[model samples]
Target chain A: MTQARLMDGTALARRIVEETAKRAADITERTGTAPCLATVLVGEDPASVTYVRMKRNRCRTAGITSRHVPLPADTTTEQLVGTLRELSADPGVHGILLQHPMGPHIDERAAFEAIAPEKDVDGVTFASFATMSFGLPGFVSCTPGGIMRLLDEYGVDPAGRRAVVVGRSAILGKPAGMLLLARDATVTYCHSRTTDLSAAVREADIVVAAVGRPRLIRGQDVKPGAVVIDAGYSPGNVGDVDFDSAVKRASLITPVPGGVGPMTIATLLEQTVDAAARQLGV
Target chain B: MTQARLMDGTALARRIVEETAKRAADITERTGTAPCLATVLVGEDPASVTYVRMKRNRCRTAGITSRHVPLPADTTTEQLVGTLRELSADPGVHGILLQHPMGPHIDERAAFEAIAPEKDVDGVTFASFATMSFGLPGFVSCTPGGIMRLLDEYGVDPAGRRAVVVGRSAILGKPAGMLLLARDATVTYCHSRTTDLSAAVREADIVVAAVGRPRLIRGQDVKPGAVVIDAGYSPGNVGDVDFDSAVKRASLITPVPGGVGPMTIATLLEQTVDAAARQLGV
Candidate 1:
């Protein structure tokens, strides 16, 4: 059998970022103001700091401004909310990003919601979730939005297909499934509480593994000729899907590091520019 | 074969309305303000008129006030939105129900969005949909909320079950599937674009038929011991499910007319009182 084709999200994300950069440049030149993204990190978690740094670097490269708001680990929920509200009201801020796992003490949803819907470029707020679920015009969660861009680039029409989403995070699996369902796919959502995960996976025409469990979806779980998306990256470069074995069965597959990761920041930058264009009336 | 047990939605709805009436009475006696529901009808379609009248009658019997706003068929979208916004701003209006099929000329979504999230007792706003999708505490679309109540009343836990929701309407099928997913059920959504509806329904442990096609789901489509909810009502009192055959194959099934209909109004009144309590600080 021929080897499965790799859905190169890296290349697609690069193209998207390039387009976004052009648009950002046009807006900056026309309006004399660059689109600004406010990165709000509640604590000094190493991983979150690195992620925020990457996003900021991407924003700079895209001709966008990145404003960092680093708070103490013990920041109260009220303080975080107040800070977010200030960012939301700022005329210069086009998008807002709040790093997650904010020490588990702060009310994350409260803080995320404090960001205005127009500025919810990371798409964590309930307002954004609702719009995404309803297929309305608004920003989507970065990762899931990237996943859709990859699927579209590959000409994967979700309509009438059995697409199983193997996780239900608010921004990732849930929104991905909703986007697929909006396109007329028969969408099923499976998670940790699921009784028979393999049974669900085996029936999918497209499988999106996002449970953050390394190699949880083995080759046997993937249907022959199915498309597999590994959105979860556990430690040691392992993905939610056992890529080596799944690649043998799946007709298309996404590699871990080079796939979903780059698309996220790409989508964030793209949306930030879009938000700025709208806000600037360009 | 042993016949499926009937899920008595009428009895359950009666009990719910009785309790809601008691609460409304309590709120009125203490605050001197009865829970008020504003029913806005655009044009006088016979069926929509009947639905609004039924809801108003139910509200009266439950000791809740019903305020009607009737607009002409040629009413502009802005006019309707202005009316809804006015109702949303009115301190006395605790709940707002905009009857469906408000003529094709009107932008239905814009009209629905005009109702404040607090007064959106009919649960049609994007905010309400977002909250319902996130499993957050908020009002839900009446019919789907009623279906959930019936499921809980029957002690049917959706967790770990295969739930296939047939239909993708804004209020009914979409929210029903989301609610089931929130309870940990592996929820699948099937719509008109589904290639083989029977194949999708056959895998379901819980089947919700809401596509408005009479007798679309037959006995062969139902899995043994499955809980079937027929939320569709076609002409001549027919349901989406072929009740005669499905009753023999399924473990639990709802009957037409008496099953899902009464529960919708009951949930409306219950949520109205709840919304009033929150608004009145009682």
Candidate 2:
């Protein structure tokens, strides 16, 4: 059996970052203001810390500056909102990214809303989500935004395709489906409430597995020659799709770690520069 | 052949309006201030004029006051936005409704965003759209809100059902699908670009025909025992669904003229009263 071609997100992300660096340099040279991203993390969650650190490293690579704001785990929602508001007001901070899964007591939506719409490069704000849903020009949720870029890089036209998104989380599955729908794809959102997930998967020309369930989608469920994008990252680096079985059936597939993960930070850095250019009026 | 039961949106709308009337009266009696809905018309489009007249009549019946602001066909976007902003700030105005398709030159989104989120009874603002998409607490687009009410009245639980939403207009189709998805229905959005609309519709337990093409969904496309909601309105009182044929196949269906039409205005009035109550602290 002919194996499916892998969609190399790592290589594509590198190209994107390279292009973004050029734009960042141009902006800084013209305006003498380096694009900066402010990442606010509440509590000392080890995973979040690591994620923030990785993003900061990518910022450095792309000629963007990073500012870290660490709040105590017991910080009040008002305090978090205040810090986000300050970052939003700072002309130096072109993009504001509030790391997710903050303390349970913190009002996540309130914190997200505190970030000015122009500075919400992470695309967690309601304003950004609205723009994405309406297909208007605005920053997109980084992972979903990266997914679109990857599709574009692979020369995949979403128009008229039957795309089934196997998740409905606000940031990932919902926005991803919205982006596909905006591109004129016939999109289906299947979640835990879906009675027959396999049946839906079989009918898809493009399958996006975004639910964090390791190997939830089996090979038999995949349509032959389908484009499979496994956006779900579970423990042990396992994806939502069973890679070994899916590779034989899919025409194109994204590997777990090197697929959506790299594209996300690349999108953030790219959008950070874009936001800076817009703010600096360059 | 067993004919499908009609969803009877007219009767439901009447009930909804009656309930809204009581709420309006109670709020007025307690606060000594009647709920007021300000309708802004950009141009004297006949359809829009008629719609505004009808809405005002309903407001009168519900004991809610109506304020009309008419602009010429050559009105600038800034002028329209200014009017909306003034109404949004007015303590007397509880809800704002802007009649759409405004001259094709007006920045409709700018005008919609001018209405305060608290007074956006028509639910056209981006903030309202985001709240609806995320299943958060806020006003919903009137027609989509009415569709949910109809579903509840008929004991149709959207959870776990296969729902196909045809059309993806900002107010109607998109919000309808999002609302269904929020209710745990596996939702598919099929538009003009869909490769096989019939096939997608045939898999749905609940089908919403919102595309304004007359009789686009035939009887054969509808799943047997499916609950069909026809939110489309075309010339000659036609709907997107072929009612004569679809009624024979579906378990429940809505008529073109009497089904979704009344519900739209009813939702607007109901939300107006709700907005007034919230604003007045009554």
True contacts kept of each: 0.92, 0.98
List, residue by residue over A113-184, the lDDT tens digit for candidate 2.
999999999998888998999899999999999999988989889999999999998899999999999999
The parts of candidate 1 lying over 4 Å away from their true place are none
Candidate 1: C-alpha lDDT: 0.92
lDDT of 1 by residue, B116-184 (tens): 999888899887987888898899999999999989999999999999999988899999999999999
lDDT of 1 at A42: 82
Highest TM-score scorer: 2
Whole-model lDDT per candidate: 0.92, 0.94
Q: B1-282, model 2: which lDDT tens digit per residue? A: 999999999999999999999999999999999999999988788999999999999999999999998889999999998898999999989999999978879999988999999999999988998899999999999999999999999999999999999999999999999999999999999999999999999999999999999999999999999999999999999999999999999999999899988999999999999999999998
DockQ of each: 0.83, 0.94
